[model samples]
Target: MIVAHWPPISATLCPKFSGHVNKPLKGLRSFTFNSSFSFKASFRCYCIKNENPNKISSEEGFSVLGSDIPWDSGSIWSTMAFYFFSLHIPFSFGGLSVVAQILHQPVIDPQTEALSILTLQTLELIGALLLLNYTAKPGYRFSVFRDVIINLGMSKRPQDRHAVGWSSPTAVNNPILKEILLSSNVSEIACILVYCIVTPLLEETVYRGFLLTSLASTMKWQQAVIITSAIFSAAHFSGENSLQLFIIGCVLGCSYCWTGSLSSSIVIHSLYNALTLTITLLS
Candidate 1:
């Protein structure tokens, strides 16, 4: 039986098949059953698994392409794993914020309240960095800062290039953002410093580093990027402004794809967040 399918396998599956992988059919273009030869050729080698003479070798196999792509079928399990186990930034930050609110006044003073917010944010940021470094494989360990900048200048989009780099740019250009960026004051400056120092490192790792990469493994780059960006945006829902939080999530997601450097994205993210926080504090 010979199975002929267009693009026998998806481009994303290329990486898994390229090397000696534990997964079956790891790196072959397609599967074909030749009863006469009764042999299987994969990678650069040929293997002969004994076959029954009575078996119909002409049994047709389905194509692994089109909407039925294997990567898109059930790869979401990996994404969920990373969301909870590796990239816990969203969960951590949300938990901290809730804790802050619940413990406010009763267990903490005004000064302590501010300090706790800062502390929680700081811990979340650290966890994001550590998660990216430790959880992701080295082959995929991209720098959010460097990679994102490079991507911006590149002529090709990830979808066009047949590569699932990261999530799309969820940040929309808003006039208010410009105004926010332009304003500056002392308290705003302090907030900006904290934001600039914290967000990029933390957010990028959580959204792009862990979430994007994990989703990309099972889903197409486009689908993975969209899903991850949604989750990233959702994490900020507890904040007062849902619209702005989603915008920030998109921007951070795109920044990661464009730069590929977790650190660089952190820098840019930190700067943006700091500016916003500063403006909020000063206003």
Candidate 2:
């Protein structure tokens, strides 16, 4: 009789744990989301502070590969810009694909993308200042830029992940997210004026609109917001100020969550981005 060896099938691939719902962060013990997350339950915990070396051991935080946005069934524009855009490194590279004939360039060049991003960023900043003058509360002046920096996370203190996490959820709740989508408060004239003429449409579409929507599919709403915001900040790596932008990313991500509208997120984002651009341009 001959003995035959067989492969092992592990049942551990899917875990069953207490307090487990079919929600995101399935097995992760640290993340706890009840029906409503109030201001008290949320607190920043630094493993280093507790002297727990085992903490932060999970590699679940950051994503370098790609997010879980559904590329197959989305609009043609989204499929083209977000998914296929990465395949084209050089202009010539995108042109090499068979689909290039029908899709023209087949992908957006990074060079052009970078330039357009900067242009829109600049435009948004100028527009924000103009809009601010008209819309800001009494006694509010551009001079308040200093106060914004101080009150916000732009201070000299070290980066706090807790602050980032708390601030990051704001993307969902912002006012501007509402203004563009469901609000008849502003006229269609105002909507088109901001969405098209004054604001940088492509920037918001790519960063908050497209990317956030994409990531939310794969990640828990919280994780998706954080990851998208990080990418948003890191994509502007040329400024030699990644930390600042990453922190800003947290704020934007949080705003998106608080509002649940990309429009609101974009409005907040446009204001913040424009402010940063102005400061950088002036400096």
Candidate 3:
């Protein structure tokens, strides 16, 4: 059972406990209990508070994963559309272009260009996050990001197990990550930041965190994953990387599903992006 709430961008994954109290469940980071949640049960246990270490240990990992996502599929589509345009339109034909024209900016190396691109992307990320919460909850911000960070257990932790799971069943490359290795376009420190940090965080938040879980509420998590991945690939376009993007989307979907933790998908996404950049830079 996977539950969705807040942006853990509250895009952070929120979890709930099973009917059985004796068994501890995999938990997400702490979130405030409000009417927005589908489950009426209290999740105060997910948070680490001023309580004794004994209590924290007792409540640390109870899961909120299950059915009952509050987001509508229609809203998810609308949000994705808005988010997509925000990413593409500005760079293609808008204020940034006019600014560059007026400034008569000199030709920049790949590194500098990467930095400029990152700046725009950073702004988009901030705006996207705020909009996601504002539109979803009307003046409400969810504790999703903090929750994700908290549950993103260390890789070597003993509790680690298969990521991407059973109830769940679950891009794009103008250039596949494979081709990127030989591109030798590491450019600005911004490029690394964009790919390794920003992209992983942003995209995973939208696709895996928000979209996939929302869809899962209406159908089998597996079917939801497939549909989400198809849309994810299409968003990137039917370029050479279309298949790659689809496959990548599946992997990410699985990671999130199996673990019931956005943190896992995020960590995996970020690391894979980092690896691609590293190999490309080295090559």
Candidate 4:
């Protein structure tokens, strides 16, 4: 016959063993003591620091990819609207006028036309810079241009190579482009400065620095890059070279994302335009 034992009320209230108390029942010993031990062990395990210092915690990883803005902030939408109205619409009108004049003119005055376009671009650039100063966070004034060049080399895949070869413009094939490229003296110098420096700086500031950063506050970085690139390409208003411009926009967007610096994108864009202009002149 089994003997029945009832634990004292004190034993039930405080399961911890004391030298003065009798040993607990065999069933209660394993259930109460082992459970407490297991819980203590688990708590200790969690308290210990991770062995790998390089490994990011789950929370940190999520924070890195997540939006930087508060849910209540409407700055993103306001900035987007400002960019569309202040920059995109005005530039689209100017670009359309240029295209129309180029098509209609029997004999183009490359110098006069280039100077007029440069004047318009300068005004637009000034407006964009002012808007950026007001709406966006302060941007880095300097970046490692060589690092961006290295990244461009490292990131190039077969598809990118194909796109570059396929979309590269030839002055011989496009008469209007050829006329612009073959300009002489002051006109050529002005065109070069506009393409290589002014245009790249303005475009990178507006699209990558302002628009992309604003969008990233509300969406994933990848989505921001895609949307910014699409808008940038569309803003160029180049019918034949639209695909080429889009591909270039994607490249610039990715560079901006990786470097987190508008200067890097500006450098890459300036270099690209200079190289293409060189090729056009040589051919």
Best by lDDT: 4
Per-residue lDDT of model 4, residues 164-276, tens digit only: 12122312244444465577677777667667767777677667765676677677777777888888766654566667777888888877776666667777887887776
TM-score, prediction 1: 0.45
TM-score of predicted structure 2: 0.33
lDDT of each: 0.44, 0.38, 0.54, 0.54
Q: Candidate 3's residue-wise lDDT over 158-199, tens digit each?
A: 000011110100121213222323334564355566666666
The stretch of ten residues in a row with the least summed lDDT in candidate 2 is: 155-164
Candidate order by lDDT, decreasing, is 4, 3, 1, 2
Give the runs in model 2 whose Cα sits over 4 Å from its true position.
1-200, 277-283
Residue 214 lDDT (model 1) = 54
Candidate structures ordered by TM-score, highest first: 3, 4, 1, 2
Global Cα lDDT for candidate 4 = 0.54
lDDT string for model 1 (1-283, tens) is 6564323222233344564333444464555655554433334333447788776433111111123212233534564456455435443434434554566532333333333434555654555444444434455345533343343211100000001111111223323323333444432333343345544545565566556655655656556667766776565434445566566656655555554445545655656654544444445
RMSD of 1: 20.9
TM-score of 4: 0.58
- Between 2 and 4, whose TM-score is larger? 4
TM value for model 3: 0.58
Measured with C-alpha atoms, the lDDT of residue 165 in candidate 4 is 20
Higher-TM-score candidate of 1 and 4: 4
Clashes of each: 30, 25, 25, 0
